[model samples]
Target: MTKKHVHSVTVSTLSDPLPSVAAKTKKTHSVWREYVKSRYLFVMLLPVIIWYAIFAYGPIYGIQLAFKEFHILDGINGSPWVGMENFKYLFFQSPDFWLVMKNTVLLSLYHIVFGFPAPIILAILFNEIRYDLFKRIAQALTYLPHFLSWVVLSGIMFIILSPTTGVVNYVMAAFGLEPIYFLGDQNYFRFTLVISAIWKEIGWGTIIYLAALVSIDTQLYEAAIMDGANRWKQTLHITLPCLLPTIAIMFIFRVGGILDAGFDQVLNLYTPGVFSVGDIIDTFVYRMGISQMQFSLTTAMGLFKNVIAFALVLLTNYLVKRSGQEGLI
Candidate 1:
């Protein structure tokens, strides 16, 4: 080829890619420009990001303490590794292990059996109510308990359940029955915990079911009515079927948290007398780690709870999916 022709070919080769290259460059610039335009939105999100970074994720480093024989003097970094010693201690060596585990599991089961369904019933009743004003008042009354912290709620419980001048006791006395110390008695403590938990959380839980109810097609109810179905039949055939997915998702989450068993509520309400029936894994961990200073052992307990919770979540989700419903996996 002639030199001029060769130069012309080189020029064409360089120019040929310019359109595509320039398009890519412009696309990249547009992305950054869009990001810059929406920077204030990100700035608004910065606090949440930082909050999670600090509170939620920052403590992840301490997970290593579960495997290490943590020492106050040696610190987390210098602590000697102990493999599964902490876990072995938690499972076999600790005196409170089985007791606390049983309490945790039983309490969770109680809550699932009674507490889980309480809100569903309440939501249904609320939905069935014809008077909007009465419904609103009832909803507000129920929702009020959820806003109270467990500490405050527990204090109120102590006052109400006290054997001396409590309103419950007063009613019992008027009925010619003995005043009972509900919180102090082991027989009553677990039941009280479950009941209180239901009372506190049922309102909040009802909110979710109410939202799900709103999404149900009104025509389904109309169709059920046209088919000569009663309220009960409609609930069974239409309302429940429509709500199955939401209920399944919530049930999965509830099962995942079985190990939790209301740490704050149990801690605040329970005394040494009720420890046999009321002391759960979280409370046991608190006593061991905070009160008694068994850092590694308590960390192991927490780690164990987390692992079981994670596994339960996965298993429940799998079962839900197998049942032909949407799951939270």
Candidate 2:
């Protein structure tokens, strides 16, 4: 009986998994255990996960429409394949496509050049303000515009910028200058769009920088002051260096969305007269997709814009890292 029991025990030991397999199984068990312990946290995150799944990722499936000759009656899956014909027309065949692409790229560049730095400057100014009450008031006033929709703000802008009786024209008349048709004239439309976009978003954009400012060590500033550094010198040295990582990350995100040149603002502010200069990818897509029902064409345009934007983000991140700054990656 003892010999039989020893033989059975040896057979069970030989049936056990090898060392590598056992190690993998143990690691997986540890991960599952940690996940079980954090189950409540996952439950808390479930809503956000659901929201993204429903609204963000769910729409991704329709991207195939870009490669199809979509027919409403035939549905997305049933639509006939068109290969690269949509992209071919977008790049070579269509007349307005190149013009729209040019406008989109130029407008995006304008925003990056002018609008990107406005919030950082404003946040620094806000940090320097000594009077708490006055700073709060200033912030509130600037932030109020961000809460208003472009549709509402555009009406306010029309009243203020009217060439005949508007406040802007009235001031110009007082200064012995001619009234400029800011919205109507193609020459001024793009600038107006850029300026208005900066004004509306600058306050909100400062929120992130201001939060980052709070995380900075006060000791750094004290040390700078002890070394006879002035405000400008301290900002140039300590403040900016500390904020560099945040700035690099934010810049990467901004570059990622470079194609999105304020659709709402442009849509509300532009007219037929300014379309040549003010028209952008989003507005063009809106007209083609919704108004004209050229779904396949517009989808191709969207796919193209998104691909370029994604490439820009990757390139920008690489450049930032190469410059010895932290990147979003």
Predicted structure with the largest TM-score when compared to the true one: 1
- Which is the leading candidate under lDDT? 1
Clashing pairs in 2: none
lDDT by residue for model 1 over 259-308, one digit each (tens)?
98999999999998989999999998898889989999988888899999
TM-scores vs. true structure, each candidate: 0.91, 0.89
Residue-by-residue lDDT tens digits, candidate 2, 215-241: 999999999999999999999998888
State, as a TM-score between 0 and 1, how close model 2 is to the true structure.
0.89
| All models, RMSD in angstroms | 3.8, 4.3
